[model samples]
Target: MSAVDEIVREWTAQLLDSGSVAALVAGLVALALVLHRATWLPLRGVVTIAHEGGHALVALLSGRTLNGIRLHSDTSGLTVSTGKPTGPGMVLTLFAGYPAVSLLGLGGAWLVTVDLAHVMLWGCVALLAAVLLAVRNVYGVLSVLVTGGAVFAVSWFATPAWQALCGALLCWFLLFGGVRPIAELRRKRSHGRAASSDADQLARLTGVPAGLWLACWFLIALVCLVFGARWLLLMPQL
Candidate 1:
């Protein structure tokens, strides 16, 4: 067999083999991060990337022109686009932010169950690379680069066991981290702040109440978490 064929055969084996990594341990570690503010605060940057990426995705898919994206130090992000202010497309673009993390978490969990933990990490690196392109601020650029580098390092340098562990931790983080921001948003909205939140913007665009939209976001996250945990833990044949 040629060298190329040997490489393909090896890679194919890696993709099919489920490395030994306990999902529960990873989930517990991620839960701790969510509970501890100091750790969770800095890590929120990853969530911001997913949030803004969701907006950017819907904008482009909706045929709107994306202006740029900005990731702030405070774990907030902005995605600007040009299009009709009031329509399903604009509403969807605005609405995608809060649910994005959970959606990603769910997807990652599915990949792991199918013995594709390695593929999941590489997918994250690719995603961050794309997000980096639309970043307009220096901070945003640095944020994406640092994040992508970390994932790339783990995916490339780590042993398969360690990579599987990290992948589980990542999915768990997304699953748990998905709910915290909505809680914060609820607090801000209760205090009459965050008038510009996605829920609020959605309210302005549509006739639905912001509170109702917030409820929907919460439900989506919760549902994703429940099902994602099942798949990650059970490792069911798919």
Candidate 2:
């Protein structure tokens, strides 16, 4: 058989044999990271990647020209794109970050529920690879490389159970991690710090209160967490 055929067959088999781990365990692991400063610090860079990638994805989808992405050392990131600065596209680009993380967590939970955690692990590797091409700084390049390499190793070489655990941890992290930043933003805004945050940007674009935008992001994240937890707590049907 040709290489493509062999690869396809292998993927098909893996898909059929996909596995899942205990949702409680994964959730707890992610919870530790979310609640602890030291543990969360290292992983914050990964969440920042997701946040910036969300902006980049929406920018492209909304017909903007993505310039490059910068992931900073402090777990902050910026995605620059050129387009109309005050239209629906811009609003969408500004609004995509928080929702994107929660939605990804939801997606990961759904994958676990459907016994496709392995698939999502590979999917993350592919995603990180794509993000790597657009990373504009040395730190961003290294971050994506390390993150993608770890996911690739897990997807390609780990046992199905380990893959499921890691996959669940990733998704669970997204779910929990998605919320902390919003709360931080709200606090900063109240203190007049994050005057240029995403919520503030949305307010500027749409003339709504930044607090309102924060509420919306917070609500969406909570809803996603609820749904994800529901999927994870219940035993996988498959």
Candidate 3:
């Protein structure tokens, strides 16, 4: 048989033999729901902390004085300093948060994939453990756990194609989930008379527009999805 014939035959057999199509569809649905919930939940606080902390740490290490730090109830806040940050410094600080959080989650997914083909299954368990541990506020923990559970269940029960679909969906959720709340918080703070000077400073220093930042984050997340799917596909079955 020709190489093309052999390749087509293999694909045809896999498609005919594997009960993955239905599973894949189900997984996609579950992933969609999880992403929707994640976008609405108030998980931006954690992201905010990571973002501002990145700025502060980079600044301190770079020999800049740390003037002040403010965290808000909505998970969007500012880090202030006496000296004006260079363009590069400001850009780094502004863009650091999403990448940090996304990378951490992606790392977690990678670790899970190393141990289990169905990494989302373990992701669910880890999230549940975090909820029990009070790793963050109750709402935050619940949000993570619930979303993780949905993804895990879908991945575990579905076929490989479904798992890939679900992973892609969750990636989108993680990417855009925190943006709306953060933007809303910024707007409210900007107009309020009680807004701190640090808020204004934060607004100024983080000069990258919110829409642009969100787009960049989504792009990074899409890249992560591709990596995650490859990892899933390569994992050995249990």
Candidate 4:
């Protein structure tokens, strides 16, 4: 078999042996529900903050001015004063959101794995401590805990091939499963406005088509999947 086929076979064997496939499905459902609730809480504010920060960071780096920033109970917004970004820049900005966060998480996991086992353990502990210190909200704390657990579990239990499969599955779940509820919530909030004005403005300014932007995001997501799989497969065997 090819390497990809071998990986898939091994993953299936492991899943069947552990009976984790069903459990994983249940866990994903539960996670989706929790994330759906989280969207209704102040935690969404953090996501919004990250999103706007992404925009602000790119704008500043590209020599644009920050016109204003608005934070509301439900959403956060930013206005940058600059001409429309060029095609590539606009695509880069839009694609930066969750992938940036995922990359940060992957980087953190890598750092933990770089040294001894005790060092990795200590790194996880320190990260947990930092989360407790920085976040005041219980929901935020829970989110951090859940995310940390996933990282630790992937690091400790799964082989690299399994990790890659799990990461890809998780990413797919987030993009399709999580996005539906989020879009529903957004539609409710916006009174069924199909097109967001901000997105329209962005498209107009960048002169980049929305479909093209989405295609770029998909490409980046694929790259991330490959990286995630490699990280899992190449992790030190205990």
lDDT of 1 by residue, 7-123 (tens): 988865654353333677678899999989989999999999999999999899999999999999988899999998888899999999889999999999888877787899999
- Which of candidates 1 and 2 reaches a greater lDDT? 1
Per-candidate TM-score against the hidden true structure = 0.89, 0.89, 0.44, 0.45
After superposition on all C-alphas, the RMSD of every candidate to the true structure, in Å, is 7.4, 8.0, 10.3, 10.1
Prediction 4 TM-score vs. true: 0.45
What is each predicted model's overall lDDT from 0 to 1? 0.88, 0.85, 0.50, 0.46
Reference-based lDDT, residue 106, model 2: 91
Clashing pairs in 3: 24-162
Candidate 2's residue-wise lDDT over 26-47, tens digit each?
Answer: 7888999998999888898888
Ranked candidates, highest TM-score first = 1, 2, 4, 3
For TM-score, candidate 1 versus 4, the one ahead is: 1
Worst 10 residues of 4 by lDDT: 172-181
Q: Model 4: per-residue lDDT, tens digit, 1-238?
A: 8999999888667653442343344335534643666633544443443344455556556666545334454443443436455665554455455344334334433432342333444454455445444444455456556656765777578765455344434433333332333344345435745355444444666766544544454555456445543443343422
| Total colliding residue pairs, candidate 2 | 0
Give the distance in Å from residue 39's predicted Cα in candidate 4 to where it truly belongs.
5.8
